[model samples]
Target: MDTNLSNYLKKEQDKLNELLSAYLSKLSMPPLLNHSTKYSIEAGGKRLRPILMKLTCEGLNGDSEKVYPAAMALEMIHTYSLIHDDLPAMDNDTYRRGMLTNHKKFDEATAILAGDGLLTNSFHVISNAACYSDTEKVFLISKLASASGLEGMVAGQLMDMQAEKESISVEQLEEIHQLKTGRLLTFSIVTGAYLAGADSMILQKMERFGNLIGLIFQIQDDILDVIGDSEIMGKASGSDEDNQKSTYPSLLGLNGAIEHKNRYVKQAKNLLEEMELNGTLLEKLVDYLGSRNQ
Candidate 1:
């Protein structure tokens, strides 16, 4: 990664870690469940979802501090998804961020409840009136709910699970990602823009950018599973093939997957160019993602 991209990602991610620590510290829940929740929250991650949110807000001359709670909520939602995804009933993974996964570090029941806690708590964080009005909070919560619910992430996960039993076309794969990954990524952009009181045109542009960025990220993930290091990825490599699931590489071959990832990144970068907002960092971020192996 370029120095600028590397520094920016690290800086924001560190900030998020602090914010999450402060927020989670105040929670008074069951001991084991709370520990399970904090286990994954404190576990190191890219914090990419929250950073995407804060950057869009910063681009619009908005205060990131005001958006911090909502940004943290995004990360919580993401972390919950990862915890559940790593469960025995799901991907059955045993490691994340170079440590035992939630289900492994703690009992499966505790991990499952911990994921539930994070998912539901995200709405409360977004709906809080710390940084925005009730109307705006409602808008954020509504969008987030749809994105994380059956209409979006749930639908995508369902498709992924069902596809494990049979072949899926490229079109079906795209639809699965558009809901599963695209909605939340788009929500990251849209939520920040809504907080900043951005005009509808800019919101529309962000919507398009978010969708392409999601595809770029997911396609690259598929490519990495084939050629990435398990140590660097913090999980076993080639788990996709091991589970007999379809992936970009499985459907389109390694070369084709790389081409598609590049195409989507370029499309996202082009959208950044057209935005009136200064999205240099976002463009660089998109470009950087194309080469991110882990």
Candidate 2:
């Protein structure tokens, strides 16, 4: 990563951590629910979604502070998804971010409620954010609901589960991830740009940019699963193959997957230039995504 980008990422991640802790501290949920939710949040992966949101806003010269609540909400939804994804009924993983998975650290029921609380509370945070107009609140809430609900990640998760242990074409795999992973990622970008007062044309292009970036991200994730170190990744490698899940490497070979990701990376950078965002943090971020280890 560029030194500037690296510093910015670390700074944003720290801010997000403090924001989450402060917000959760203010909530009045049950003791266990609060603890379980905080446990998962504190497990601490890259706060990619919120970072992307803040970066997009800053790249547009928008007031980054205006998006703080939305950024927090985005992270909460992301953490909720991870918590549920690690459940025994989902990926059945025992660890995440080098720590016990939510269900492993706490019981399954508590984990379930933790995920639920985060997901639901995300909207509450948005709706109550006084910075946005009522119209903006409705827009944020609706977009988030679609992005994280049945039309988005949840639907993608179902498709992923159904496709497990089954051979799927590359297009099919992309479709699964486009919903399951891409939507929320896209949400981070589009919402950030929209709140930054980007015009409809720019928003459309950003949406496309977001989708391409999402594909690039998922492609890299697929690549990492095949070759990543468990200690570095903070999760077991080869879990996809163990589960017989289809991935870029499984279908395209490792080299082919790299080539495919490069194609997207190039297109993403090109799209940034078209948006006149070349030489910006967003462009640097595309490079970071191409080479991310985890």
Candidate 3:
């Protein structure tokens, strides 16, 4: 993509940051809890999940502003995951999003509490919808909780931990990643449709599209970790290999991972075309994920 296009994305992401910060400020917490929560939520990152939620809502003819609570909740869940993922018990990283990891910047205990705060606060955000009906709010919260909880991201994390230092089949690897990484992404889109009151047919299609993008996103991360720059990626490079984790590039060669990501991108685009969607932001996002360096 051109620099102008990427710059536009950055601009939209900044809008999300502003909204998130405002909502976060309204929540009640102690001083230390507030500080730790702010540390991770305010940390620099792409904020892709919230952006996707906004775009998906727009595509469904829903008010983007009405979707802000769900979008913010999605981002909070994502931030919480990153905070925990960087813990010593997890990836044990010291850097994230081009800054010191939460544990590294704060003590490990503080980081853990920060992650917990974000995760719990996410539910609070989802529960109070300014525009959605009670039923719709419940639906959104249930879907998000399911996607971010035991059956989804958390389960995937457990599988990842278990698979470390051991070789697993490609199918098993994909299953682990689908739950660990893809679940929330899928929820990000599907929740938009649900909040928009989309028909079941459209919602199902959106779910498929989200799943494809989620897998592509994870595959790209695997590829980048092997070849990306630490300065650009904002974390230690080669950590996946250093930790002996099972990754797409480790199982499939670099070229193979590229091909695999392309396949998923194509699948996602085809699904979008089937829905007759006009937004290029999602398309651009898929392209960006396939081609991202960090």
Candidate 4:
């Protein structure tokens, strides 16, 4: 990855932080509920989903400013998923983003409610994207909902839970991760295309690119869990091994996981280039993914 791309992602990430803070401040709920919700939403994360949404919009000739609300909504959904995933019944993690997991910091009930609030509130943010035409707003909202709901991330999570400690085929693992990790990513890119009124061909290409990157991202996470530092990863490392979860690195050898990640990264870059779209930022984003230390 280029050093310049890392610098640029840092700058773009700062803007995402500002947007998150501003949006969180505007939220209105009962004081206790609001505090619970804010606790996890404000916790630091890489904010990759929103960044991808904004960059995809920019790549397809849409205004990033106009797409910011939708982008932020994506982040909320992602964060909510993380909150829920860390519950004792799920991954049972105690740390996240270098801070206590919501359940650990607060309590399981509060963390559950916080996740619920964030999930419901995410739609409000997307619906507020009415600055665009009714059709565009409707399209984006529907797409995001599908990605976050049953047919997407939820399905993936269910599969993951069911497959824990069991041997799964390569195809099964891919299916699980694609749903668990790839669907929202697909929505992020497709939402940008809808807002920009891009043709079906462009949307299809972007979808392919997003799916490829999403899988690559998961594979990298699996690799990191095996080899990454706990401090840098902000979560327990080697938990996949301890939990006996089926992961790419578990199903494939460590070397195989590295090979798979490199292959997907190459495929993602090729798809982006084939789109012939001005994805300078998106290209940099993909390279950064390939090079991310954690």
Higher lDDT: candidate 1 or 3?
1
Q: Tell me the spans in candidate 3 whose CA falls farther than 4 Å from its real position.
A: 2-8
Q: Give the alpha carbon lDDT tens digit for every residue of 1-294 in model 2.
A: 799999998998898899899999999888998899999888777998898888888888888898889989988999999999989998898888889999999899999999999999999999999899999999999999999898899999999999996899999999999999899889999988988899999899889999998999999999989999888898889988888889999999999999999999999888889888899988999999999998
lDDT of 3 at 66: 79
Choose the strongest candidate by lDDT: 2
Top TM-score prediction, candidate number: 2
- When superposed on Cα atoms, how far off is each prediction in RMSD? 1.4, 0.9, 1.6, 1.7
Looking at model 4, report the run of 10 residues with the lowest lDDT sum: 1-10
- Model 4 ranges off by over 4 Å: 277-279
Q: Give the per-residue lDDT digits (tens) of candidate 1, residues 1-294.
A: 878878988988898888887777788887887788888999968887877887788777777667788888888999999999889898788888898999899889889899999999888777764767888778888888899898889888888888889999988888988888889988998877777778899899889888987888889888889999888888788889998888999999999999888888777777777775545676667877788978
The alpha-carbon root-mean-square deviation between model 3 and the true structure, to one decimal in Å, is: 1.6
The lDDT, on a scale of 0 to 1, for candidate 1 is: 0.84
Model 2 stretches with alpha carbons more than 4 Å out: none
Ranking by TM-score: 2, 1, 3, 4
Please report how far candidate 3 places residue 116 from its true position, in Å. Answer: 1.4
TM-score of each: 0.96, 0.98, 0.95, 0.94
Winner by lDDT between candidate 4 and candidate 3:
3
Which residue pairs clash within candidate 3? Answer: none
lDDT comparing candidate 2 with the true structure = 0.91
